[model samples]
Target: MANYVFGVDIGGTTVKIGLFTTQGEMVEKWEITTRTDEGGKYILSDIAASVEDKLAEKRIEKSDVAGVGMGVPGPVKADGTVIKCVNLGWGIFNVEEELSKLLALPVKAGNDANMAALGEMWQGGGKGHKDIVMVTLGTGVGGGIILDGKMLAGTNGAGGEIGHICVNDDETEVCGCGNKGCLEQYTSATGIVRMAKIILNTTDKPSKLRQIQYISAKEIFDAAKEGDELAATLVENHGKVLGKALAQIACVVDPEIFVIGGGVSRAGDILIDTTAKYFAQYAFHACRQTKFALATLGNDAGMYGGACSILNQ
Candidate 1:
């Protein structure tokens, strides 16, 4: 086995790569635009070349490398074919076979959120806990589940898609998946911003938020920190929706802990404090034992997750 493993997170906008020691320390990391519009052929070629260049720079031979793992933004078949990638403009990609041929190393591929969960399980907030759930609050929400010390990817590989779980029957805004009332409609970063806009437009109340043309969820979070009642209420609204959805999920899975991660999670206690309160109100009494915490691995969790996926094999 090689002395180091390589991890790659294939996000919608960028590809993050990291070289990691067996002990899970990241030695070096970098990123490149995904540019998936160029076709899967060029994408794989570029990845292969980049790996080759990195190996040469470090004077590491292929024989000294342990393995490679990749986290892609879509479902992957057990045999490594991508079922489809909505963001990458590709379908049925033979990721493992093609990349292994070019790089002369074993490659493991999995759903990006699942890999992130694995990373948290191995090194972040979920460390030392076998059964865990990771919720990433990004442009959208992504969830991953680990049960009985194993990552659960249901048949057809679409499990843990918690964002689409319907929470508000009265909500009308359709999700990208063509569904209305999904949890993301109220819980995602974009959803929070939409709520902020509604508050600004509907109320005559004076507020600092009106000065900005396009407000982001982060701005709302910042405003809440400064004791803005409207911003605080917006966050509370988001928490209630997310909590209702998570309560439903918790009833079924019963994970030991829930780790919240991603950029929006940086809202810290403002988000967590509200979420914990709402989650308790919404969840069944039996599920009250499940602890909630922020993810410790931060942005590198995706790359670490990719590496952990390889370790699993």
Candidate 2:
């Protein structure tokens, strides 16, 4: 009988693999280096070998496994085709079919961000809520939307590209997506540092942030926590933009909760508190009271989400 499932989260540097019961309890997890060489020719074969070794080590029969669910770092078609993943040196291809053929098992795939949100909804911050939007703030911002317990992987797989939402039409600098004034340009970790530099250069504000040679989003939050005036301003500005964008998202999805994750979310309550404050200020009346929470699963979220996908399927 099919009693187990495998969850794989593919990243630029590593691939995180997890073994789980059909009930969603993780049994074991491990990682392998991602070989991006030769246009990622070895990635699928490597994963197949690793999965075989793991099943053998666990004495689990191939027939006893339900399937493998993978999370890729790029847009994925509904049929599990990856359009492209520059970081992984990949081009358009059917990841599901290739990996399935290699392993001789069923496979399912989705965008990593969407998988993270699914994980959160299944077992993390958004567990109790069926409708939620997850925003991941790292070097850049990533997002995913879940409605009525299903992921909305829209046409072209760009449903939850919230980071690219144009927030500042006046911005002179273009975003990584080649857009000017994207939400990521102001709310990401790098965006915070960029804003801090502009604040330091444009204004002679007597603040502790001016002392740091290399400023990071964490540093800014730390200084803000200590009551640094300029740092507080920067944090507030970050909150304003982020909260406003979230409010806009709420207008569309009307999710019950907003789960915040990624590296920048390390600021904890301060980030949520400030963003909530601004969200209330700008949100539509009916959605103004929407809840916000921090993602508790961290990096393992993708693994859990991958497993959830197969179980749900």
Candidate 3:
């Protein structure tokens, strides 16, 4: 009989779980709606049930599994307690201790973005690299930093918050974290849409984008490809902001490579090209030599990271 490991990534709307062999091959995967509005305690019960169901389906005993790892969206204590989860509307809670007791197995926990970075390092784009930075551009910006081959979580495990880095000192749009002018204000999917709307309101340019009922970053990218000056310029502007932000981060971390992921990254080389141009301009000459690559792990990164959490410590 072969032993396996279980990894779970808990998110706002859903929870993804994966079973993997020691060699890193994912043998099974599944997801369940999080129903977070129902409260945090319900989530714990559901997770326990889900693990039991998976074990039964595979005809495996608890002893057959090596360990279980989890990724949470909020700040986690080094000891595995959740400090707070704004998205889930919960305050401080102990996830690791509770889960381990309920499941009768060792459980490791980490911030979701940090786990994603570990996933990339262990099996995805950063496989060969020891020092890496993983950034996710989505509804909001998310990140995880690895330095000198170690997953870096400062004293409270909130250290990898590259998204919260201030990009505009005087600008006012407040972030969910209550700070103003955060990097997410410019680079997230919502930020891109906000930038597009600003152009739409200020310019009288003839654009196919004006016809859309609702605009998204995808529509903006498509319109830019079709030669809409407003859309193209918006992308360029976003690229510049993203590049500048990255350059600043690179100067401090000096990681070997920076992997870009999340939904917005689907724009591919166009986004990469624009961001790279600005990154080159802002980065120190020596830092400009660092590599920027698209993330290869996709959504599965969370699960892989969970499966490999023991390696993180």
Q: Between the candidate structures 2 and 3, which one is better when assessed by TM-score?
A: 2
Tens digit per residue, CA lDDT, model 3, 59-92 = 9887778778898998877788888887776678
Off by over 4 Å in 2: none
Give a tens-digit lDDT track for model 2, residues 31-140: 99999998998998999999999999999999999999898999988888899999899999999999999999999899999999989999899998989999999999
User: Which candidate number would show the highest TM-score if scored against the true structure?
Assistant: 2
lDDT of 1 at 287: 96
Model 3 per-residue lDDT at 47: 85
**Better model by TM-score: candidate 1 vs candidate 2:** 2
- After superposing candidate 1 on the true structure, give the runs of residues whose Cα lies further than 4 Å from its correct spot: none
lDDT of candidate 3?
0.86
lDDT of each: 0.84, 0.93, 0.86
Deviating ranges (above 4 Å) for candidate 3? 35-38
Question: Candidate 1, clashing residue pairs?
Answer: 2-64, 2-65
